[model samples]
Target: MNDEEARTRLLDAAEALFYAEGIQAVGMDRIRTESGIPLKRLYRLYPAKEALVTAYLERRDRRWMASLSAATRGQADPVGAVFEWLAEWFSEPDFRGCAFLNAYGELGAGPAGVLDVVRRHKAELRALLAGIAGPGREGLAEQLLLLVEGATVVAALEPGPGAAVRAREAAYVLVRADGTG
Candidate 1:
């Protein structure tokens, strides 16, 4: 494969494994084995497992931002956009939890860079919330984030559409109460 395709394959493999299996539980060998690429090629792309994890998070973040941007199009209202943006997540099959958050949880803390990705992803989510939530509601954004995470957790536990529905309802109430609904 060419450079771009190879890189994409490696990242795709990492995303699948990292999401399906825990980040810490997955190793470079498995990533290589799953990708059908040789170990040497994998190393050339990612020098370390941590770097691969970072790349996985980055790929996911980019996809997330793209989805959010596309889904919220023509809806200038931030809160409304957020609710619609969430539809993508709720609609997905096998949605377990936030991959970044899950990675952090599974890894049990690591080098600064690993945690940095989690923090950065979180900040991005919060910023999206703040934009939709309107002015002077940082606390509200954080709270809404918690609600989102809670919903994700519940959905993961319950294994049905009901959990997502509940989350959307709770989110509607939360944002509406803040006058952004």
Candidate 2:
């Protein structure tokens, strides 16, 4: 395959392995094997494992946000739509909490860009929530962000989408109380 194709394959393998397992647990050799890319080529494509991890997270962040935006776009109740989207995501068979959070937990203190990626993802999410919450409701947006993150963690720990459901209920109350719902 060409460079682009090889890069995509490497990233695909990296994302799957890293997300299914954890960043530190999956090595470059395994990624090479999974992607069917030669070790030399894999190293050439991503000079280091940290580079690969950062690339994986960057791509995932883009796709994740895009999916969320698509799901909530044009909805009459954008805030409710956000929770509804989370519920669906939580119910996915391969659901495993937030990938960015998982990466942060695994490699936050490292010299890698994992922390940067995680922070950017979160800030973008909060911005989305803020837009939905509208101007002058920054506190509400922050509250909603906490609920979303909390629900994601709780969902990861528990079975089913109970956390998202409960979070959605709480969000409704908050929004109503804020007179925005």
Candidate 3:
């Protein structure tokens, strides 16, 4: 394949392996094998495993935020709409909690770069929620973020009943209490 295709394949393999397993548990050679990309090319694309991990997170951040944005676009209540989006994400067959949260739990301290990416992704998400919440709703943003993170973790661990549904209900209460929805 060409350079672009090779890059995509490498990233695809890295994302799957890193998310399915932890970042530390997966190796560059395994990524090479999974992607079918040669070692030399893999090194050229991502000179170090840290770089690959960062890229995996960056790509996932973009895709996740974009999907959430699209799903909530032009809605009457974006904050509530966000919870709806989360419910769908929770229901995905391969739902494995928030990728950022999982990665942070695995490699947040050592790799500084990965932690930065995770923090930035979460900050951006909070910012999005704040914008949707409008002015004077700073507390609303914090509360909704907590609800989202809690629901994601709980849903991943015990997805039997109404984790996302309950979170969604709580989100609506917060939004309406803030008089924004």
Candidate 4:
């Protein structure tokens, strides 16, 4: 295959394996076997497993944010739209918690780059919430973020869904209290 196809295949494999199983648990050879790309080509594309992991996280961040963006585009209540997106994500069949959070839990203290990516993703999420919240509601944005993160953890741990619903209810209360609801 061509370089672009090979790179896509490699990253697809990495995203699947790394997200399903912890990043540290999966090795380069396994990625190669999963991707069906030759070892030499894999090395040429990623250069190192760290690079691959970084790329996977970066790609996931972009895609995740984009999905939320598209789902919430043009909504009057951006905060509610965000919770809607979260609820949608929480209901997915193979939903395995937030990828960035999972990565941090597994490798937060392992690599600087990994932690950087997680932090950046979260910061972006906060910024998005802040923008949606509008002026004079910075505190509301922070509380909403906490609710979002907490809902993610709770939904991941609980046997059933509706964490997002409950969090959204709390967010609504915050928004109304802030005069933005």
Candidate 5:
């Protein structure tokens, strides 16, 4: 495999194990074994386990944003765009939790660039939601944000449609209460 192929394999392996088993449980050795990438190539690409984990997150972020953007392209209503994004997430068979949130849990409060990326991505999401929610609804963003986060976690834990339905209900109530929807 070429350098990019090896890197993709490593990230794919790391992303799955980190999400399923948590970061601490997924050591470098396991990633090497799963990815079929030699130690030398792994180390050359990512000098540390944390770096590999961080890169995995970056890959996730890009994929998620691209998917979201494509799903929402040319939608006349911004609010609908946001819901479509969430709905598509719910549609995933193995949605689990938001990769950024999972990464945050694994990394704790470590002062790494990966943490910064996670934070910034979440913040951008909030801003996007707020923009769609419209002006003078700052509180709506926070409320909807919490609901979506709750929905993702609940789905990951229970793997059911009810959690997503509940989240949508909560969102409806929030939008009604906040006058954003």
Candidate 6:
């Protein structure tokens, strides 16, 4: 296979295994086996496991944000749309909370690149929320971000989309009380 194809396959395998089983739990050999890429080629491609992890997270961030943006696009109420999207995401059978948060919890202190990616992902999410909130609602954006993150954690613990539903309702109340709903 070509280098680009090999890289994509490796990343696909890495993302699946790492997100499902935590980063530290999956090794390079397993990624090689899963991706069907030779060990030597994998090493040449990634150089280090940390590089692979960082690439996985960076790609995931792009894909995740793109999905969220697509879901909320053209909506009259982007803030509400975000929660609606979260509800659907939480209801998925493979739901396992925020991948960035999961990675942080697993290896927050181990790799600087990993931690930076996590932080950047969160900051981007917050920025998206802020744009949805519009001007004079910075505080609301922060509050909404908290609700989103909290609901994600809660949804992970409890099955279904109850947390997102409750969070959505709370968000509406906050927006209404803030005179922006």
> Which candidate model has the greater TM-score, 3 or 5?
3
> Which pairs clash (backbone N, Cα, C closer than 3 Å) in model 1?
78-132
lDDT of 6 at 41: 100
Model 4 residue 5 CA deviation in Å: 1.1
Q: Write the per-residue lDDT of candidate 1 for residues 1-181, one digit (tens) a residue.
A: 7968988888988898889878878889998988888999889888888888988898898898777766655675555556555655755775767787788887757756778888888888778767656689887888877876676677666655565566667777877787754
Worst 10 residues of 5 by lDDT: 77-86
Structure candidate 2, residue pairs in collision: none
Error of 5 at 47 (Å): 0.3
For all candidates in order, the CA lDDT equals 0.76, 0.90, 0.87, 0.86, 0.79, 0.93
Model 2: per-residue Cα lDDT at residue 107? 75
TM-score of each: 0.87, 0.97, 0.94, 0.94, 0.86, 0.97
lDDT of 3 by residue, 59-127 (tens): 999999999989888997676688778888888777788889998888757788888999999999998
Ranking by TM-score: 6, 2, 3, 4, 1, 5
- The weakest ten consecutive residues by lDDT in model 3 span 156-165
Candidate 4 ranges beyond 4 A from true positions: none
Ranking by lDDT: 6, 2, 3, 4, 5, 1
What's the TM for model 3? 0.94
User: lDDT tens string, model 5, 1-181?
Assistant: 7999999999999998887788888889999999999988999999998789778887888787677667656778545555656766766776777788887887778948779889988887787667657688888888878887888888777765666677777778888887644
Q: Which candidate is the best by lDDT?
A: 6
Over the stretch 1-181, how does candidate 4's per-residue lDDT look in tens digits? 8999998999999999987888889999999999999999999988988788888999999999888877767897777788878888888777778889998888766778878888999999898888778777889889988998999998787624599889989998888888875
* Residues 1-181 of candidate 2: C-alpha lDDT, one tens digit per residue: 8999999999999998999899889989999999999999998989988889889989998999999988888999888788889888899888888999998888766844777888899999999889889999999999999999999999888846788889999999999999987
Global CA lDDT computed for model 4: 0.86
